[model samples]
Target: MNTFSIKPTICFDTGSIEYLKNIKNKRVCIVTDPFMIKSGAADKITNIFKANKVEYEIFSEIKPDPTVQTVAAGVNKMRTFKPDVIIALGGGSSIDATKSIILFTVKILNASGDEYKKPLFIAIPTTSGTGSEVTSFSVITMGTTKFPLVDDKIIPDIAIIDADFVKTVPPQITADTAMDVLTHAIEAYVSTNNSDYTDALAEKAIKIVFEYLIKAYENGEDLEAREKLHNASCMAGMAFTNASLGINHSIAHTLGGNFHIPHGRANSILLPYVIKYNANLESGEETEAGKRYAKLSKILGLPCSSISEGVKSIIVAIKILMKTTNIPMNLKEVNIDKNDFLNKLESMVNDALNDKCTATNPIKPSKEELTQLFQEIYGE
Candidate 1:
């Protein structure tokens, strides 16, 4: 059997949450946060569950960059509800918390020897980005370190994608999360661990991002833009979910894990710099540079004579997008003191080196090279 897991049955468009009524599970516990509730999406889901007569409960206290204690608390709530279904109805943090809760309640509860049982999970993403609805990885922040729980079992049994839910996303989030999509695509495409299946998906996702991200960021209420961005994000998720990512993500994960930086924003700030550094490698003409850079440039309607020029042009385009979206181009803008960054540089480098994604980088960096990359990003 060529066993590879995929996401749950996906439904897109307005009123797609109605599909929740047909779910087979009995008790459904919705793991979310106050923001989604405030945005009225939580109530929409609650009303849908109520209308369907499905027994449900809501644990809406999940924090941004969820913590272990938060997930444990959610697990405790699951123990109370003994839910057959877990509905994650927010951004990546909420979805991740739901995954951890399911694992703890199903796999870890009253179990031994580090074994876990996974329950059915359904995800309704209010954001057009993150693609958490279809992903099997969960990033949980515990203390100062962000830990990734990777397992196909975490993939949701259903993904309800409604662009209407994304209509209210502010431009800043649209930019940050959309950049996340781009990073996911680029990293997955260039990963040495990539396969043919993931490559096809990554290419399509990269095209979609170049076509739609800026439009989505500029006009949140544009349903077409929102839908395209949603699809792109999902495609990127599928790509990285299979082939994994590169140092941009690995380093971003480390910085976020250690310093509590927002995952998407960290990736956004580092992506251009990382690409610049990666492109400087004299690996070989047979490497991925031509296809990688040319495809992106063509997608963005930029003309370049060489792969190096195309790479530089894409970086410039990305920087322009960041500027237009009000995303700071460097880490200093996010308030990390130069001293703190320098002080923690060694640990951050170690963490990145240890990251699972690091093994697949198109051009692996030495400690000295990584240090230089960090300094460049810091000053950019």
Candidate 2:
């Protein structure tokens, strides 16, 4: 039997940050990056706590592509602080790191046969990407590998969508994160495990991204565009969390961890190629994934004379969007050394193949095919 679920209580209204004030007589741990604290975004939430007289501590060491070391440290801090509410406030990295911290802390407590009270987990995304706020998956970097930890325990209890926090995001980040939202929706829509529930959410997310991403990217002050994209990001997150993801995320995880590429940018660079690869018709027969792509193309009102043509139109449109946003189309454009990429290509392939996301990929790629795909992405 197939299953679908959405666990988080989403709050997306003006002044949604004020929700934190509800936690009274509790220790709250604010997990975020240094930038959020430095840029005064963290204050937005902290001020609420202060007004409500809620005791709070800030953990601001989370970095981009959060590392195992950082998570372990955060877990230690959480154990010592014994917070009742844990607020993940920032981009995907911070939320992901916070999830790992909570998971590990619980594991440690459970190992000692201690009854651990789970904290109220809240994720407030400052950027409209990753949907990490609502997803049960957390991507953590270990050395040169990204391990995606998936568990229902890691999913947040609450998600706060405040467009005010995203107003200061730079254009490049806006473009990259918007593309990440697109990738999430598209991959979820075409996943082998997709259901009607996920498909509807994914389709709506895709429409929203196409309609509002450019507006948000071109003008960050556009609250209407920001709000729409933020909602789209969370919707895609919910869709993928239920339907799971595909090889696109697996590849992005590997590329980001190994090459120090930003997660969204890595996904953006690989998306078009992945779409084309997944949609390739073998023996002149349409794959289920290809049919899904065709349907999505039709939904978007792209050229759709046939299944193949429809799939090709989606790929073309993605390329045009990437170009318009100034995203790199290949690994070379991002300045990765050709020799280093070649050396690490096999390991990358192996990691991607073993990734949890790969289990739901519509097209199961062979080792040789994966190797070829990497080389092609490298522009060899």
Q: Over the full model, what C-alpha lDDT does candidate 1 score relative to the true structure?
A: 0.80
- lDDT values, one for every candidate: 0.80, 0.91
Give candidate 1's error at residue 57 in angstroms.
Answer: 0.8
lDDT, model 2, position 214: 84
lDDT of 2 at 155: 96
- Cα lDDT, model 1, residue 46: 78
Position 39, candidate 1: lDDT:
72
Which 10 consecutive residues of model 1 have the lowest summed lDDT? Answer: 110-119
| Pairs in steric clash, model 1 | 8-157, 107-116, 107-117, 146-257
Clashes of each: 4, 0
Least accurate 10 contiguous residues by lDDT in model 2: 13-22
Per-residue lDDT tens digits of candidate 2, residues 52-96?
898999999999988989999998898899899999999999999
